[model samples]
Structures are given as C-alpha cells and as structure tokens.
Target chain A: MQNKLHYEFEHQAMATQFSIQIVGEEYEDAETASMLCFQRLDALELVLSRFVPDSDISRINRMKSGDELLLDFETWDVLKKAIAIHQKTDGAFDIGVAEYVDVFRATKQGILSDFEMVNALQSVFKKAQNASIYVDPETPKIYCVQEGMTFDLGAIGKGFALDQLSELLEELSIKNYVINAGNSSVLAKGVSKNASCWSFPISSAREEFAVQLNNSAVSATGTFFQGDHIFDPRIGQNICNSMYERVWVSSQSAALSDAYSTACFLLEKEQFNELLQNNSEIAWIAISENGKIQFFTQKNIPLAQYLIS
Target chain B: MLAGTGLVLANPFTASASVLSANDKVNVAIVGCGGRGSGMIFNNIPKIPSANLVAVCDIVESRREKARDRFYTLFDKKIKAYENFYEMLEKENLDAVVLATPDFWHMQHSVDAMEAGLHVYCEKAMSNKLEDAKKMAQVMKKTGKLLQIGRQRRSNDRYRFTHQILLEREKMFGRLTHAMGQWNRSKIWTMKPNKQDKIDISKLKQYGFDTVDQVYNWRNYTKLGGGVVSDLGSHQIDIFNWFLGSYPHTIYATGNNSYFNFEQADTMATILEYDTPNGPAIGIYENISNSRAIGVYERFIGDNGAFIISEGKDNKIYRESRVKSDVWQKYIDAGYISNMADMKKYKAKQSGDSGIMETAPQISYNINEMRDMDKVYNLPAHTAHLYNFIESVRGEETLNYDAETSYKSEVCIYKIHEAINAGGAKVTIDPLEYIV
Candidate 1:
C-alpha cells in the first residue's frame, strides 16, 4: 500500500470544492490518470456551462421567442433523466420549476414588474402543458414539440458528473479513489489513511475537516445557509421547513447519494418513510427545528452506534 | 447606535472603523438553538466583538438549557430561553436572528426575522429547494434586510480569491476550458431509529412532526429537506458558477440508493457545460455516499494552466507547460509555445493561501495581474466577501456577491441537476427560457 502510487488533485467545482484522490501502481501513471480525469471533467463542463454563450444549452436559451432549436446530445440526455425522476417521484422532483422561478428572481431584481412577472410565469405554466418534450436514446436527440418548453437540472447534475468521473477512473484502471463534487455528491471506491469507514460528523459544529472516513457515501442537505429557499415549483410557495430538515443519503455511488437525497427531500412523510422501508441501506439524521436531532434509518442504528461503536 | 443584540462589527467594509470598540457589541438571539444554532453561536462569537447571546429558543426545554449552559460557560452570557421561536422573535428585540432551523422552517423564520426589521444570518444551501430560495431572496429585497447567508465560503478568503483570479483576469486561467470538483466521504454510517414511544408514529408521514427520527432526521426523507444537492452541493456548485463567470449551459447527472436504500440517491455525479463568448467550457462534479477515498478537494483546469484549491489547505497551480507534448508538438513547432510562454510569464501570480494561512504559492501572469485585489486575495474569498457584505450594509462598498451574482451560481447548479436528469444531455441555462 505504501509503495502504491497515489495522486490527489483538488479543483473548485459546484459551489463548495472537490478533492480527488486516486491510487495506482505508478506515480507518473497515477498523475497522468488524474490529469485525464480532469480533462474529461473539463469536456463535460464545456458542453454544459451556463456562462458560455454558444454552449448548446445557452444557444437553446438564446433562441428567439419563436425560434425552434435543436437539442444537443448532452441537453437531451439531461431531459431524459429529468423525466425519469419526475415520473419516479410522481413529480415530487421537477426541473420545470425553473421556468416559474426565474421570473420571480427577475422581479426581485427590479428587472420585471410584479404584474409582469406573475403574468410571465403564468404564461410559462400555461405553455408547460403544450410543451412536448421527447428524448430519443437511439439517436440521442432531445426534441421539444412546443417551443416554450425549457429544462432545468439543478437537482441531479452532480450525480451525473460523479458517474462520469467514476467511469473515467475505472477506464484509467485507477482502483482505490474518491471523487467528491463538494462533500455533498461523491464517488468513493476505497478506504482512506484510516482503516475505519469514513465518518462524517452530523452535528452543526462547522469544523473544516472530516472526523473519520473510509469507503462510504455521506451527504447532508441541510438548510443551513439559505432559509426556506427551496420552493416547490409545483406551487410557487415555500415548503414547510420540517423538524427533520437535513437529508443525508449514503449509497454505493455519489451520484445516487446526491440524487436520492434531493428526491427524498422533496418527498412527504408517507413517501419518504415508504422509500426508507423498502430501501434499508440508507440512513439519515435530521436536526429538528425544535433543536432535537433525530435519526431515521431502515435499521435501528443509533447515532451513538456510528459515533462510539 | 446599532441598538440590537449581535451587533459584533461596527462595519465589515470600512476597516477604518474600530470593530472591537469596547462599547460596540452585537446582541443576538439564537432560534432553534440546537446543534447548528449553538455551533453558529460558537463559530461567530469568537470572531466578533462583544456579541452578547441575548436569548435562546428551542421547542425542547432541555435543549434550551443545554444551549444556555454552553453560552454561559463559553462567554459568561445569560440567555433568555424560550419554547417557541416566534415568541422569541416577537419579544427578544435582537439585532439579528441566527436561524439554525431545519430546511422547512427557514423561510418562515427568516421572513419573520426580516419583517421584524432584524438582520438575519441564515445558513447554507439557502432554503431546502428553489422555491424557498426565491422566497427568501424576495423577502430580503422587500424588507431591505441585511440577509447574510450562512454560506461561510461567501465569507472565507480561499474561495473568493480563486473567483477573482479565474474570472476578472484577461482570460488569465486561459479560457477555463474545463473544470471539475468533488466531495468524497467515507461511510456516513447510519442514525439509529428514534424510540417509538417518543411521539405519534403516524405523523412520520406528515410535514413537520416533532418525532426524534422525523424532526431531527427529517432530511433523510424528502419533503422536509432538499437532499444532499440542495444541502451540500449548492455551496460548491455556487462556487463553480462564481469562478467560471456564469452558470452551466448544460448538465447531466445520475445516482442510485444502492448503499442507503433511501428514496433519494445517496451518491451522484454531474456534468456542467459552460458556453463562453469564445466557445465552451465544461465542469464535472461528483458526490459519493458509501466510501471515503477522499481526493482532489477542489480543482480548476483551463487551456493554459490549472489551479487546485482547498479550505485551510494549500492551493496549488500546475501550468500545462508541457508545450512539446505529442499532440501539442506540432503547435509548439508552429510558434504557439512562444506566445503561450509570454502570456504565462506576464500573468500576475499569488499562489499561496492568500494570507489566510501559509500554504503553497500561486503562479499567474505578471505584475499587471497583481493589480487586481481579488486575485491578490486568492481563495478563502469568504473573509473579504463577508467584509464586503458588511461594508455594503454599512455604506462602505457594494456587496459583490449580491442576489444577482449569487443567483448565477444557483442557476448553474440547477442547470447541472437538470442536465444530468436528462441522462447527461444538454439543456439551456439562460434565465430567459419561455416560462415553464
């Protein structure tokens, strides 16, 4: 293990940051592999960065009011996944919320009048029904039957990145590693310097470092910074901030962990508990609004069990 | 006279003003004083001057006692404890509200605090989801309230410095063609089920039950929280947008509940594409649930050179100076190497940890680049950002990371999730989409 070539690379992505640690047999080979992984990630960003003007997504957004745009491979791919999650969660999770929400944002910035914003958002909602979106996996084409339709992927992009990074790492034959998009979404394959499983502290201690971690998925989606900013697009109202407010999902893939955490956060109690019952592997600890920290898991594992075991 | 509790700084912007004047103190009240609320109490108290903990509110009496005791022990401050957050807000007359509540309650508490004419320092990921984020922003605007998001990175120096260097410079990072970041964790393990006898069992399906598992562990389920992406990814993705100069044009993602068979995906990956005026850039990100082989805390790659950043850790830059590489040998022979070298040599450089802590040195172009205070500051941009925000509020300078700039990151992260949900397809990131 000591002789094994392990290289670590760090990049600022998502909003937080990322640290990628890869271990292989040769140092030069590992560094090259890390570089390759970084390059692949770069390619992924080119096709997707919203800041770019000519990007496929940006072009679509820049399309004139009546213009019809052809969807790119990556855009179409995101549309398909959105539909699946929306369907799976019975629309509990929907990217369509962006259409209504952006108008609200403009209004707050004084770019749009309140009435204009409302009317504009209502127009979008009305057109939403007319908007026909279809993705053909064969040709990988995403077509919008209605010109008014728009797609948003704020919920699951990190997961997709994780999957891509994982495949890239695997392709590089780099076996023991982890790629984290910001401590929230991550892909981990092996243990760390410590022999024990990586332990993530659930308390709101604000420590910059992790406690103990090795070969496990941990994600905490707590409304720590922005208050009830996550509005349900279905209804342009803020959802109730629950006592059990943070959703930490642990799974095999960081993508899954990130996605499920988002999905679960959107789900109600019956749906959430039902999913937990069916899937016993994931466990969550939430800090209640009442200052009580509760634990919900498929099993009866206590916080103490993980903390002190 | 700032006649409220928690008025720690005279003003973050105007450094000329004495922040720790013996008479100037910030009187604050902690709502939902649990782990996070208490943690915030500890985290900020030491940084600010004379921040008196005026009150503590918690639904649980015992928890309130624990907080009060801790506050007393930590700062020798007597805290008035309460059972209801609303009651505390109505009566406390605090300078600010530290809303350390759950995802669902953040909106209400923040709105209430703002309406009460108090400054609010809320925690990260903003609200649980997009709607909540918007509402919170709206309320802040309407109230003209000093709403400081708990995204400490907004206050940290490391993150801000990178944004300045990569963005403000003349394509200094060389068109920032590609970027990738990740957060890897070991086994987060499991939280034990709350004892069944504590409360109503049927309420587990409700939106706001106070059960141990339901309230404290509500984030594990959906309705109560926005999952890990909204919770954790929001922060990092926000940084991505800030440094990249805009939102992601396209995004694609996927995840599974393989490890923690919860309703949500425990682990996931995202691919974000940025469309520059020149061409395109890409960002690849990831989050894992089960394993903990943490690596590459943060990396920003560009056409000319790349930068690697970490919090409280050294941020290093590695130039793609291998101009004579196999693929680039032809270009090198064609005179691209000389121009590249000249550009690289002239770029302003400030490699280390931007005066936060001694780390590695940052390499950039020449003295011209050094003029921009942002790059000179480098990562840990949060410190400057906080100071800026306070300064803006205190009539010092404008808050650079206002709703608009902050929204850029929001829109980008949302686009990434949207793109990935489409099975790694592309999607428009512009805000002017034809409605829904």
Candidate 2:
C-alpha cells in the first residue's frame, strides 16, 4: 500500500531523467499537465542544449570576438542566474571553464594520453585567459567580446528546468507537487495527503539522511553523484583536497539550490561558513570525507526542522 | 482585388496584396493557440529577425489572451488577440499567418489565410481528410500565394545537405536500395482541462470540438486528427518521398487501437514501396504511441553507404566496409564528410589489443555542412522554414516545400492511414494522384 494517492510521471531531457509527482490531482489532469510540462522541457532543451547546433548556447560558443547573438528568453534567464551565482561564489562556480572541464573529463575517461592531456590543459588555460562572455542585462542578447570559450549548463540546467516547470505548474493551478531532475535537484510544494512533507533519501560516502521538503528545493552534489568530475574553475584544477565529501543546499528556488550546492561543494569550510552567514535563508548539510556530518540552518528552517533518518 | 478580375475577394481587411519590398519586415499573426501554436508564438517566430508578430487568434478566449500576454512578457512586444480567425484577419494588418492548429483545421486556416492575401506556414499532415488537404493546395494555386507546409526537415540544413550535396551531387549513398524510419513515443499526449477555462461548452462546438479534451488532446480523436499515422508518420514519410526523389507507388500498413483505446486511433507500422531513379526501393516507417524505443529518426541505406538524420540527436553517415577507404578520401578532403574514426588505420601502427576482439565499430563519417551549421544555432530548420516563407513573401527566395509538393507527400501519408484502417491492406497509388 502507498501512503499517498498521487500520480507520478517520468521524462528525459537535458541528458537526464526527470520525474513529476502531483498530489491530490485527478489522474487525467495530472497526466495532461505533465505532458505539457515535458513538451516545454523539450523546447527548452532545444534552446539550451550545446549539442543542439542552432541552440543559443551553441551559437554563443561558436561566436567570434565582438560577436553578439540574440538568445532565447529561457537561455537568457538561465545565463542571468548563472552569472549571479558566479559572482556570488566569487569565481568558485564558473561556466567559462568548459574547455578545462572537457579536458579533465577526457583524461578521466582514458581518452587523452599524458602528453596530449598536458597540451590540452595548457591550450585551454591560454584560451580561458583571453576569453570573456557577457549577457545583456536589458535584453536576451549575449555578447562575446573576446570569444574562444564554450559553456556547458550540465551543473545547473536541470535545476533551472525544475524552477521553470514550477512556474508552469503554478499556472496550471497544480499547487501540491514534487518534481525531481534525476534525483539531484528536487522541488516540493504544499503537503501530500498522508505526509506533511515530501522526503527523499540522500547519502554521501557514509552518512545517510532524508530531508523533508515543503514549498522548497534540495540539491546535492558530491563524489557519490558527480563522481569526481567536479572541478574548481577558479584555479583551473580539480578539487584534490576537499573538506567535504558531499554537500546539499536547500533553498526556496531549485536553480539556487542546484547551482549553490556545486558552489558550496567547491567552497572551503570557512568560505561556506561565510556564505551561510551572508545568505541567512539558505540552509545546508555537509558530510565530511571522514563521515562526520554538519548542518547549517535556522531554528525553523524546513530542512533542519523536519530532518529525518 | 486583382483589378476587377470578375471575382470578389473574401477578405474584408485588404485589397490586393503587394509584394513586400526587400528588407521590409513581415507583419505576421499565428492562429490556433494550442501546443504547437504556443511553440510558434514563444519559440520559432520570435527568433526570426524579419518577422513581426502583430496578432494571435484562437477560439478559446483564455488561451488567446494567455498567449498574447505571455508573448508580451517574454519578447517585450504587445500583440492583439482575437477569439475568431476572421476578426484577426479583418483587423490585423498582416503579411503572413502561421497555422499551428489541429490537423483538422490546417486546411481551413490555410485556405482562409491564402484567400486573405497572406502567405501561410501550415503545420503538416496538411489535414485530417485527404480531400481537405487537396483543397488546400488548390486554394494556394488559385490565390497564387506561398504555402510552406511544416515538414520542417525539408528546410533543415543537414537534411538539405544530405539530399542535395551528398546524395544528389556526390552520390554518397549510391544506388539507394532501401530506407527506414520510425517515430516512437512512450504515450499519446493527453492534456488536462484548463482549471481557469471560462468558455461556454456551447461555444466549444463552434471550434470543431465536442469537449475540452478533444480540443486539448486533438490527435487522439478521429474527427480532429488522423491518429499516429498522420500525426507522427507524416513528417518521416515526407522525407522518404523527398530524399528518394519520388512518391511511393504502393503502401502497406498494420496497426491496432490497443493502447489508449481511443475511439478510432491506432498505432501504425507501414511499408511504402517506391521506384526511384536509382532503382526500386522500400521505405519502412512505424509510429508507436506506447513505446519510445529507438527514438525518432529516418535512415536511408544504399550499396555504397547509409546515413541517419533527424531534428533530434541522430545524425551519422556510415561507409560500407566492402568499399575501399580511398573512395571516401576525396569526400573527406572536400569537406563533404569527415571520418568519425579510422581504427583500422590506427591499429596498423599501434600496440597489440586485448584477447577479446569485440565487434568492429562501423567506420562512420559526418556531413560537413551539418557540422558547420551545427556549430551555430542561429537558423534552426523550423525558423528557416518560416524565414523561407517570409523571404518568399519578399520575393527574395522561393518556397522550399510549396503547397503542391507537400500535397504529394500527404497523398502518400493518407494512403498509409487507409492501408492501416483497412486491416493491413496494400493500397496502390497512381503517380498521377501525387500531382495535386
């Protein structure tokens, strides 16, 4: 027997699986809303996916120096958030490290020889030094003043998609729902019939916990999920000596939770403590490499207040 | 309208239409504020620099208003909204209209727009009924206006390059013997009733829908759509007729209304037999509403090589092992195609391999035009299709998939529907039937 009488639907987009659960809605209505949401997601993928040749991101990647391209509004929205996160994290989270990330990934997959890997890294570092991309604040336009940079939204794309879906759900009058993007970023709204909040099991190297979510989002990133592919873009190197094994960010917005979870993972313990102090509303959980656990939150924060095993 | 040609024009808005001068922006309106219509309003139309979306029309008042408000918020431009098509036609000063409504409405909306001295980019399968689709082409001929059917692949740079440069020019896929395609979906779309819908049920009947579900999930209903065959198969079948350079001489199909169990809808698997200039060939297509296995793409195979192309991810060209690698070196050097990998050449000088010898990967190549175009996302095929229509309106470029050519593809699609509906029967099509 199930505790909730909700409908669940799954879709694939942004190269990841996504699932939506609608609570207390009629099946016909839930299915319809999900289908529409998936369609919107597909459209977003077309505009956002780098693999999509004519997508705004791909066009931006291929732009010459001093080239400007009008962007799809959705891409513009994502870039706006990404720029904010990049600034707030003070270079810890950067989308411009796509070249370096690609080299590291290829090296990890055994596709690059030792000599080729060093040369590739050196080449990307030189390119990064000379490249800077900007988004138009007033319109959906991206300008590449010194082009030769690529961007991959794999870090925050699904979270951004969840936030967009949440808007659509609100338009559809679907108030009570839980939506997840491949279980990495999840947004919960309202309360289900049987439970006061939605709960998802989360883990790191050792510590296991579940966060109860209501009208909020939880995003986690670590070796458990990201598999050491996480790179510190500021230094042009990997996070070889990280204080934490896994970290989760709980925010009212999925895009924030997702992007910052990564930023938080890359941040040192002191830097994260400072970030927490600056953003009082954001709560976090960290599982250390040695299996120690920590929670940073307020007294009544949903994540801390409703923490479960 | 035409200097007193003894015919009264149906449009009350304008007299005779003048050709848009070079560099003149096209005033456009989109009718049918449904899913596809919303896509055009939100995604495609906004991307085209030469298009000015001035108005929108839908039978559902809320949908029309929502589309208008959303378009304004996203693009920072206000557009008028109308619940009736004729009112939008009469009030809005427009050069063209995009018909993204249900398949049943494509013909009527297209004919009305053409009659109103406006170019049209109508979504395809053209119409639910063959006669209606044929009538739409006839109206285009009568109006002498441009009609670009939404077989968007026809305008895709990859598909165009594959057909025109590779297959036709370089003979990449030599002596084309067979082609196959599939459009598989996990489930048929079923939309929920709008919670904020304010329209009266009586008014819904005026839009060719009995209930709101029919309006929302039109493809599942017989009266509003032609089910899986026409809805999904049409796009791929059009490619078969196009890339093969001829319409199918005969079609055989099998399908069942087992899943979803909608009144008259069915899952279809069809085989279209064609006689091409190269030789006789078979084009196989299947549209399954229940399983999304293999995704959506079209594949064409020949003696020399084979290639698969789609608006989605599948884009690859394979060389036959029986053919010498030197035969393709010229193409690679000319930037026609690039070798994906040359393992045989790499292994000739490299170290030894593992004991287990796996299946050798297909020596594949990718078309270069597609590659270069893929490097930039400025002119997606859908946007290019609309651009082609607007450019044609300005006399800059002719229509790529004109009404008559699209009508020919429809003749083949409708025959597949007929063959399936008749329980796997083989339907022969006279080549004259495709002449419109």
Candidate 3:
C-alpha cells in the first residue's frame, strides 16, 4: 500500500473562508486540483453572491414584477434545488428572506427606528410570501411575477459550491479529498491511508464521539457566529429560542446536507423524523440546550453507536 | 541633488513651483477618455475640490464628446474636447494633464505634455516598450516637471499603514523572507465594439489600430499593450518591490495562451530573486485569466508573522505560533491587530458546550474595523493618487512614485514579459540595467 500525503489550500470567498484538502501521491497534482476547485467556487460566487451588484441573484432582486431575465445554468440549477428544498421543508427554508435580513441589519445599525423596523419587516415578509417567482428549469429563465421578492442564498450557497468543487475534483480523477466551507459544512470522499473511513467528531458538553463519513457531506448550523440571525420564514422572524443549540446533518449531497441542517434547527423532532422517512439518505444529529443529543438516521448504526458512546 | 558621479537624483519637483498659490485651482485636462481615463474624469476629479477638469482628449471622437457632456452635466462647467492631444495641449492652459492612454501612447503623450510645461500623472506599466518608458523618465528629468506614476497602491491608506506603521514602526512581521501575489480573473476583459461607439477604420489606423476592437481592448494585443503580465502583474509586482525595498536580481517565467486563445499569454507565473537588506528573499507572482478564484491580493511572509494585504476587503495579518503571544498582545491591545475568530462581537449566549474543536488558533487582524477607520480618515485609492499629483503640482506634497523609481520596476516587469514570451526562459537582470 502506498502512503499518500495530504495537501490543503485556504481561500476567502462568499464573505467567509473555505479550505480544500486532498490526499494524493504527489502534492503538485493535489494543488492543481485544489486550484481548479476554487475556480469553480469563484464562478459560482460571481453568479450567486448578493454583494456583487451584477450577480444574477442581485439582478433578480432588482427586477420588477413581470420582468423576465435569463439566468446562468448554474444559477438555475441552484434555484431548482432551493425550490425543491423549500417544498420538502414545508417553507421552513426560504431564499426570499433577504428582505428580513436587510431590515434586521438596518435596525442593528440604528438606521431604522423600532417602529419603522417592525413595519418594514412586516411589509417585506408579506411581499416575499406572496411574490410569485417563476423559474423554468429547462430554459433557465426566471420571471418575477410579483415585485419585492429578493433571494439570499447564504444558508445553502456554500454547500452548493462545495458540491461543484466535488464535481471538479472527480472530473480531474482525484478521489480522496475533503473540502470544508468554514467549519460549518464539509464534504469528504474516500478514506485516509491510516483509517478505514474518514472520521469527523460530533461534540456536546457531556460527551463527544467520532462519526465515520465516506463519500458524504456534513453541515452544522447554530447561533454560534452571529446569534439568532437565522430567520424562520414561517414565523417571519429570527430564531431566538435557545432550545435548539445546534443541528448537524450528513448526506451524500452537500446541498441537501446544508439545507436540511438549517431546516432541522427549526423543525420539531417529529417533523424531522417525517423528513427522514421520505429521504432515507440523510442522517442527522441535533443537540439541545441541556447537552442532550438526538439521532434520526440508521444509515450506519455501528458508526452512530460509536459516536454516541 | 547631484552625486559626485554627476548623476541627477531624478526628482522632478525640485526645480521650481509651477502652480504655487494655495488658493489657485489647478487646471487639469485628461489625455485619454477610455475606461481608466473616464474613471478618473468621473470618480477622481469630482472628489478633488482644488482641481478643475478643463479639457478632454481622445482619438475616439465619441468618447471625448461623452466625456465633455459628462463633465458639463455633473459640474455644470463647459470643458473643451479634442481628438488630437497636441491640439488640446496647445489650447488649454492646464497645470497638469492626466495620461490614461494606452501603453504605446504613454511616452508620447506624457513627454509632449511635460515639454508643453504641464505636470503629468501617467498610468502604470509606464509604456509597453522599454525604450519609450525610459524616455518618459528622461523627459521628466530634463524638463523639470513633476511626473507621478499611477501605481495607485502607493497612495492606498491600508498599504501605507501596513508599510509605514506595521512593517517599519512596529516591526509586525519580522525579517520578511518571502512574498507572493496573484491576480486571477475570468475571461471578460475583451470589449465588443457597440455600433454607436464604432470609429472609422481610417481614424483607427491613424491612431495605429487596425480594428475598433483593438482600439477599445488594447490590453489584449502586444503591439498596443503589454499583455496580462504588464497589465495586471505589474501592479502587484510593484508592491513586492516597494515593500521589499529592493529590485529583483533575476527572473524566470512561464506563460501560455492555452485557455483564453488570445493574442497575448493569458496565464503567467514568474519567480523573482531579490537581495534585501535583511537577507536574500524570493518573490513569486502569477496572473490567471481563467480563474478569479483567489481574487487578487499580495502576501508577505516573515519569520514571525505574515500579512495578506490588498485594496479589497480580503486583508489580514497572522502571527506564527512560535512567537510569544504576549508580543502580539500589545498590538492587539493597541488595536493594531484583532483576533481572527472574534467571539466578543457575537451576541450568542455562551454555553459550556464544546461543539467542535479547532485544530489551531486562527489569528487574523480586524480588517473591517481598520477599513471603517480608513473611510473616515482617507480618500479612496484612485482619488488619493490623483490628489497626490495635484498636491505635488501645488507644492503641498512631493510625488509619491516619481518616474525614475517606477521605471526600475518596469524594467523588471519587461524582463518577466521577455522570459514568458521566450517560453519559460530565465532572464538575469544586471544591477546596472535598473539605473534608468
């Protein structure tokens, strides 16, 4: 058996940091693969980043009702995935929450008074909920049937990009790799030389355990970074409850892992079980305020037991 | 000041003051009204209250006309527009002229403007051809006119703070040993000539352009521009030289147009050797046309720390773990640096929960706070560069990057260009060659 070396590269994108680690016989090939992966990530960011004035998402946000615009294939595919997830999550995961984000940001910055912030947030929520955003996946054309609809892909853009990175790496014939978007989301492929399966830790106050992941992605979501900034579209307000401290989801698809992790943070236990019943590929672990853990998948029962122990 | 060997110091502002009065508004004219030129017209000139834009000149008629109308509409002042630069130089009583023309025309326009008794602010990669670039410097020396090269990073507040305070004063990153910079961008620089913006072929040929696209997107061709190396690499490489305080001794480069299929090489990487005062160091730079992945930034690594600095918000400083934490704590206390994972700013209630264990302490400077401070204290990069020129013309400040200093970096850039064109050849630059 040949011992493989690992190479890693770190870069900043989507207003956060991302890293790629690959195990290969040669470092140069791994470096090249990493560069190519970052290129795909950059292209995705140019289309998806709301900060870019001319990005497709930004252009869509600025469009009036009845305006039809052409979107890139990548943008169209991501939106299709987003719409499907929105349906699966029963509208718990909405991309049209950018308006609420803007209002919250304004209020935090003291740009809007409390009365104005409430009125503005309520107005934007109503518009966004009622706004008809039409997407033709075949033609990749988007029509804004109603105005005041804005999209913020912050929750899922990184995972979507990581999936693209995986595709690029696979195209290059590089098999063993682990790509991480910040510490919140990760995609792992193949096992390391020393281990039979790639292992990641699931930690809580009372205990910590290692879950072996192979050809899979894991995404964790919490109020750890910005504190209750994740707005629940159903409530038309941010999630301030401390009951759900953190939620982690593992799936073969990074996009699904990211979306479900976010949805699980707000979903009831029975609701999450229902979601898992329909989508058996996903495995989830959620931690509550009292350091209690709950597991919702039997994909790898031994690994789950190893983790819980 | 002259040396014993009769070498003039190449200081263009030492002779005499041309625009002396504090109250006098410096009359300025733009020599090129294309992308960068028009940027200066709309963005830079409007920000400088002491400078008045008096005329606009370009070979393209529509560009000059639009520039004229833009200035008129924005400032409510009538400015003259001309196709011939000499005609504009002859008519306008300009104290300074901003040369945003193509690399091939930089020498002719800057030399002419200086000989016409006006100060000059010429854009970077001073010229495509080395001889023309040298002559621009020589003319500045002979004519005794202030010539400021548009290496706008010299005027950037963050860069200045990094060089002056962090590196020089505080010795933040000790014994700088290596520097690397990259400018990766997608293939979108090519310009398609709009029907309304098209120029007659005869007029284009008169300006030495064979096609309208060539006239608009000059940087893509070798005859009119210096390709990606000179167009993009020059900016970052200049920073390497500036911060290192030394010229590169040797250069080896490799580039190809395999991806973009453009006339010039679309991707290039160069390794530069330098002997700084501390010791010998290496500089590596690459510009890729197919990937805007890492975006653009320059990193300086040392024994104790490293910093990633750019005009963009992707600026950061990191301290090596071997160094004592207390050494950097003073900088953090003094607000020179900040923790990369800033937990204090997060409003989340801290649980004793250990969610994930980090492998290492990711320490990074608080660039956002620094940038916000920059907004209150400093002008934007482009406006600051132009304002520096205007101030130097008015005898308020000396030129930041005089022609001679800029020519030295251009010499190294042209060598890298030569090596890349020769297919990964290594070029040795003599110390004497840098003395323009």
Model 3, range B299-374, lDDT digits (tens) per residue? Answer: 9999999988876546678889898978887876776565632332222223223233323234455432332232
Model 3 misplaced regions, further than 4 Å: A1-309, B1-23, B340-361, B367-377
Candidate 2 per-residue lDDT, tens place, B1-436, comes to 1121110112222232211222469999998888778878886777666778899988888899999999877777889998888888888889999888888988888888898898898988789999999999999999998888987878777777777778888787788888899987888776666787667789888888899778777888888888877777888888888889988998988888888799655577888899999889999888778877678989999999898888776778888888898888888777677653211221222222422333434457765534333222346677778877887888877888998998898888788778877989999998889887
Quality of candidate 1's docking, in CAPRI categories?
A: incorrect
Q: What is the interface RMSD of candidate 2, in Å?
A: 18.6
**Models, CA RMSD each:** 27.4, 8.7, 18.0
List DockQ for all candidates: 0.01, 0.26, 0.02
Better of 1 and 3 by TM-score: 3
In model 3, the Cα lDDT at residue A178 comes to 87
Using TM-score as the measure, the top candidate is: 2
**Any residue pairs clashing in model 3, and if so which?**
none
* Quality of candidate 1 docking, DockQ: 0.01
- Tens digit of lDDT per residue, candidate 3, span A244-273? 777889888888889888888888877866
Where is model 3 chain B poorest over a 10-residue stretch in terms of lDDT? B1-10
Models sorted by lDDT, best on top:
2, 3, 1
For model 3, the local distance difference test gives 0.76
- What is the lDDT for A189 in model 2? 95
